[model samples]
Target chain A: MTTTSTKGQRLPQTSKRSAKAAASDKRPDEDASAGARRRQIMQEAARLFGTRGFEATTIRDIAAATGILGGSIYYHFASKEDIFVAVHGAGMEKITQAVLAAIEGVEDPWDRLEAAAVAHCNDLLGSSEVPVIVSPYYSESLKGLRETLVAQRDRYETVVADLVEALDLPPDVDRSLFRLNFLGALNWMPTWYRPSARLSPADIGRQLVQGLRPR
Target chain B: MTTTSTKGQRLPQTSKRSAKAAASDKRPDEDASAGARRRQIMQEAARLFGTRGFEATTIRDIAAATGILGGSIYYHFASKEDIFVAVHGAGMEKITQAVLAAIEGVEDPWDRLEAAAVAHCNDLLGSSEVPVIVSPYYSESLKGLRETLVAQRDRYETVVADLVEALDLPPDVDRSLFRLNFLGALNWMPTWYRPSARLSPADIGRQLVQGLRPR
Candidate 1:
């Protein structure tokens, strides 16, 4: 498990398709500014998706929020779905990095899980933009996009799964369900978490792990 | 706590406005079939909302699904949002009823909570239509409807809260977060749960509770 742990590791891996697309089909003028503009579009689109949901949000809305003309957005991404994929990918990267950094020096398995949880909670509940879009409710209409989002999400999930596998639990415990329930608790926080709440994200994360820790 | 238990007690309370409108504004001819037609609209709309999301789904889709003309849907609902409210209200009533019945005569607080969780899991993950719509990802655009949905959701939440309050846990436990985490785990199931999974809904519910039960 320690060998597999993502601690102190800089994971530069993006999804293969996106990498290939960037290499082959992207415009020749791609530069630092173009990269920044793409990020800007994703950030603005993430905000809208968080507020209005994927379907209700439009390319026009993203362009307007980013202060670019709607047609200009097509220059960066093929469609709204493409923008969503980018935002989702960015969000997954953000949280995955957060979790990896938090668990870097933690040796104990349960403690590592707790650290990851704290980092996850902070990233998810601390901000209103990227993480929210990362876990948007997957309605059937988004079926075509769901596979891509879930695959991206699974990269982060594998880190958590490895941590759960390292825990010293009773043989009867189902580790898969354990990991799912642990994540469900953390991910579900945004629905009820308030910034003013006395429990900071770290506190919430610790409490969650404490509740589930084997006696 | 049992005194406040909703067990065996029928909760007929719907939101005030809906009840009032159902009485005053509804036509006198709202006979058995009219009531059935209204339910049909809600069921179809719930399915669409589950598959297509609230923003993407339209009255036309609901009408088409219900085998009624789009304009005639106005007779059953004033707007798509109205249909959403109806479906959500109906879903709340459904899970509430399932939970209330489940905890009935279960005396131990933990056992009662487990019972409620089992019932909740069954209802939420068992079917595709109602419970799915009940917890739609609330975006900023849905701010006007959030209060109503949250209020309706709270009626069921109170039951869980009361159950949590009855638990004999460490003094340090934040019961509010405890309840939130517990409900979050259960509610998040629909995102990843598959009917083919080896764990039955009952098994999943029991497992969730067992994981949290204090040693």
Candidate 2:
């Protein structure tokens, strides 16, 4: 009964408890291996799901890609949607952590905002799965799973909202849309972004954040 | 003909001309009817294709949506992909015209930029198909279509680049990336934008453009 209800948890609180339950059900060594197996399946599944349409990628494809048996894949994930949610939740967690860590100890509101953008830009540029898995969360195929996916995504919003609040933008400025404009430009990076592009993510992030200052 | 050729053209150029040719080979009214039918099918197909997955949308489904006989759809569109290209191309042309009209005769670069953003935002908010059809241009199902889709998309980039070039940013500003940040933020509106978001699209667009000013 010590477990907290996670209906509103933005982070993956359930994963830890689920792991603990599995640990108690199995030997410690088996528990470690199962966790690793689940992770491996997710990475491969994300690749296939990202490259191949999610509907097109069958359970056997995910299993074969990760070198696991199809029947055993079910032991880790109940269904394909469950795997997608896990992969998506994990990706959101990764970037959120990166952004939060980057702004750590930054005292200036503007500087903190810039730092958060830079961290986010780098993560989007560096991670293959970050954009691929996250972009499809809005698609029709994920209509049933949107609530769960959106909650994970909203966790990142709290960080940006805090940054915007600290900016103390003028009342005339619509702060919510300001935050959205800042984020939209950042997320749109995956569309035209190429490694050959001359500007580093930090430089771009700074330019975007600079737009929020009083004209 | 001095007219530049569109690389990877998916639909017949000058549907009237093609229809006329078909008419000469068939009957007199065929030319006008062919052109009108082509437009009608593309409009309804776009509606369905925008809401439904492109691959998942069958020719029969398109015919049913448009109230055209199943076999006649082939007369207007050689294949499903051809219809897709036509709808996508038409959508791009519509928005391009809107933005161009907005920026026309505006001497001040900043004024031009804001006007352009406002027009774009209004169009995206007002049009149902703008976000839906344009998004699929980036999907894996369109791998064979990427060259054509990207070329059409790049046509819009020239407009943004010209605006950015007029701004005459400091030598330190990465103009290409600066352009991307502006466009990305603007393009991202479709993801989170809602009628109740408390800010009009024009208001948000103006705010985004104002970010271009130096601190």
Among these predictions, the greatest TM-score belongs to 1
> What is candidate 1's CAPRI-style docking category based on DockQ?
acceptable
* TM-scores of all candidate predictions against the true structure: 0.85, 0.82
lDDT score, candidate 2, position B162: 89
> Tens-digit lDDT track for model 1 on B5-124?
222332233222343345554474554455667777888887777666677777777878999867676655566777777888788888988999999999999999899999999998
Across A168-189, the per-residue lDDT of candidate 2 in tens digits comes to 6656666777788788888878
Q: Report the TM-score of the second chain of model 1 against its true counterpart.
A: 0.83
| CAPRI verdict (incorrect, acceptable, medium, high) for model 2 | acceptable
Q: All candidates' lDDT scores?
A: 0.78, 0.73
Clashing pairs in 1: A140-B51
Question: Given candidate 1, what's the lDDT at residue B12?
Answer: 32
Please give the fraction of native interface contacts (Cα pairs under 8 Å between A and B) kept by each candidate. Answer: 0.55, 0.51
